[model samples]
Target: MTLLTYLVPVVALLAQVAALPATSSAIHPRAPLAGQFAGDIGACPPLPMRTTVPTSVKDLRPDDFKAVMAIGDSITAAFAAEGMKLNPVENILENRGISFTMGGDKGAVTVANMLKRFSPKIVGASTGDRIVSLCSGRLCGIGGYFPQDRFNAALSGAKVENLDRELNYLIKTVKEDKTINYQKDWKFMSILIGANDMCDVCDGTNLDGDTYERLIRAAFEKVRINLPNTVINVMTIFKVSEIWPLTKNELQCKIKRALGLKALCGCAFVDGDTASGVAKRKVMDDYAAIWNQRLLKVVTEYRGKYDNFAVILDPAGGNTPLTQFDPSFVSNIDCFHPSERAHKYMARNLWNNLFLDSTNKAQKWPKDLDNTIYCPTATDRIQVA
Candidate 1:
């Protein structure tokens, strides 16, 4: 009858509520409208074979050699300077992957401008000049672009309606740019786009998830036509829910409460809608998840279409249990931008999946240690201009 006894019962009830199962269509009418994603989540067909997650593949060597280019938005632009540390080149393919920018913006981004920037790099022909070319034959490049690339050409405020325009612009750019011989020089292409489309449209009056699949398919088709000989690598999106949890959204709360009542079950507990105190750190992680899945679909489809093309999953494997690594060793922090360590990780992951080479496990890579010996104190976070 004491406080301890009363609290025990309450805690037990909450735990039981959390464990309940959930059943519903992936997208509801109140959710965002994905032109093609509007089918019954249960009845919708499994994603095409091309969408399979990437597994270990050959290491790309320095000799796999050819021209290359990179394209996308702020996330892609962040690759320069300290941003490179976010995902290291060594972690990508083994040898320090040679990479240089084609073009990118910090805010909004789209595929049209990406094609324009990327064209110059591929035709710049030289052996080491080939940037991060994974496959060899002609020029090859990888674009870990933000999802907005799939839709709007302007990259300002993207939407599903803009997808066709973006694709056509890429095609037209390749056809018109005389300096770069798209047919003669281009050999391989890697695409990582579409996260923003979902992030922007996830809530509101239209709640269909079917359109996501359709738009992706159409984009791939455009790639097939525009770059015929190129081997395309597609990477599936990693789990962002770990970084950006779903239950945190106001819209999600309504769904949880409704489901709990409609199904005669405690959906709030199971869906985590009632957890009043989610940490700030946890919320940031969940936000990352929301954006992750959007681009992953694009990567999967590209890989599934062609044999020479490859698929990579979780470029930053979540199992590592570390978010931001030390800038000096594994990371280079430019504000929120990745440190050198992080870039190295990205480079190695790319190398492992496409290139055939020994793992660069013996490099001067930093340990996952946060020991006081190497760890910085309060002084590190301070800045003076």
Candidate 2:
């Protein structure tokens, strides 16, 4: 029988496991994620605020930066919308071509294949180029994900578990190719995966919350091994139920649940077993919560982990008024994939979150140490009003 065929029963079993909701499952509610913008941009637990870096590559004066490279699935591909020549390859790679390689699917990716494709020629590249990376670039996926910011290799369908193979690939590549050292030139890496793991299974569908945690942990271990000193930033997945109706799938059921529709009363997006029914809706919330908790553990474990390596979470930084955006401009065209507009928003948000004001209000790059101190209490909120 085919793997999916063989796993049908297994998926059912997993769903049963997560379906058992607690009599009083109290979701730990925290403060609304504080952003410089207006609206319900959720926030994660407070991280020790680091002084923002005034100058990012995007802030580079005319002569300062060139060439940027992105590696991953469709999202990255979409980010490369203007074609390879206009892609970040110019800012980060300085004209050197990037080797394109990846294994992608609508709902999942495998670590094994990802490892097979990680070659120095692509990621490690030659010595002259810089790396500007993003991954789990696309959305709607199943398994095999590794979260790290060593290079922009984040891809959709990349689960937290797949980090081991990805890191191993990087380690092997660097070892074999003496000229490419991520430690010396690793500029920035972005982590935007995990939504798929959670979103893959929908209501009354299969599930496995426990294995998912293990996978995330495994990926963390691998990340530490490969890109120890790079600046790592993690972006939280968004609540998609509000946009469910916009999706092509019959997500009305999921939307109803999210909106407290009849059968979904009191159902937190991540409630397991009982949640099995709305597998699609719960995946993003559950996977993120699981990944976040474990990620915190990994962060603690890797404290002072890598030289200059740090983790920052940007939850709810997505363009707000998503419902109000011009349908033509709002991507995620397949209801699953991000359109060019979405990718542009993601790239800009990521760029601003890690280096500039989180509000995305700073009109210009900070000029000096003095300018760095100008971070305001909050910038103009991102309200559609």
Candidate 3:
């Protein structure tokens, strides 16, 4: 059976699973404590109060951010992230509460939680379980189903083309929230898109380098025009082609493939080390490089162009090989999507990246996942310049 044909049943199964009532079997696993990474690391001792909050995006400190927002695909929605070792059906739910970028569930080591240590009043981090079926266009909520989605407008199965819709939703939602000062509050927005586009390269999606660049640049332009006092972290797309050989041997991954249910990135999961497979892998790698290059170019063009707007390129997953992590870093459900462990590691890396200039940010996964969270001092500002 073709991979596309297998995806048909998988979609139907996901819908059925979404309707099933919650049970003990469906309970998500608890995320690791943020403090476990180091000894009794509580919230940062309050930094000496700022003399006056900075008005420009380039000068704002981490604590100055008043809101957190995100846009991407399943990874940001955190599909199947919490129930990695649980029943496959149960793993289909969106675990937004612990997503690396915008999740706000207590005890979960997420960027939102990490930021809360600094700016306790910041709004927009997603919380609780979000029904995967309800995740769609602006119909989901003004700013996504509140508490469950908050300002995280990301949708599962989204591509670069869908970013405009997500950005519109985010803009409307933030404007609607009464607590936020839309024109004045410092906002931190994280974006990790293009993975879905890269996944469809071999699927005849026709998303070549130029097309990718145009679509992504258009999305950033919208952000620059609409969202003032915003600092955007434009993360580079992952080298997903490298994941196939590392995961092909896993039993659950094997069964999912046999049933044609492993459709997240069909281009990356091609079988065997034969000439055809090697050729396809190389093509995916080339496309990934092109996509990331275009993304960097888009960010570079936005630099220093506006005083209240800054876009920083975060090279977290861009260069890291899948082999750098243990097998547990990926979900056991479909052997795709990052597990909660991976999210914790990502939270730390992202937090540390905020303190350093873009040029000095670590390009590889930290050798020590534990104790990697960087504590900001009196002098640290969220780096965008």
Q: Highest TM-score, which number?
A: 3
Ranking 1 against 3 by TM-score, winner: 3
- Tens-place lDDT per residue, model 1, 63-93, is 1213333222223322222322223332121
The model with the greatest lDDT is 3
Residues 225-281 of candidate 3 have per-residue lDDT tens digits of 787888899888878777777777777777766665556566777544667666766
TM-score of 1: 0.40
TM-score of 2: 0.46
Candidate 1 Cα misplacement greater than 4 A, ranges = 1-71, 79-169, 177-180, 194-208, 238-335, 356-385
**Per-candidate TM-score against the hidden true structure:** 0.40, 0.46, 0.86
Candidates 2 and 3 compared by TM-score, better number: 3
Candidate 3 colliding pairs? none
lDDT of 1: 0.30
RMSD of each: 21.1, 15.6, 7.3
Off by over 4 Å in 3: 1-43, 84-89, 133-147
lDDT, residue 32, model 3 = 18
All models: lDDT?
Answer: 0.30, 0.33, 0.72
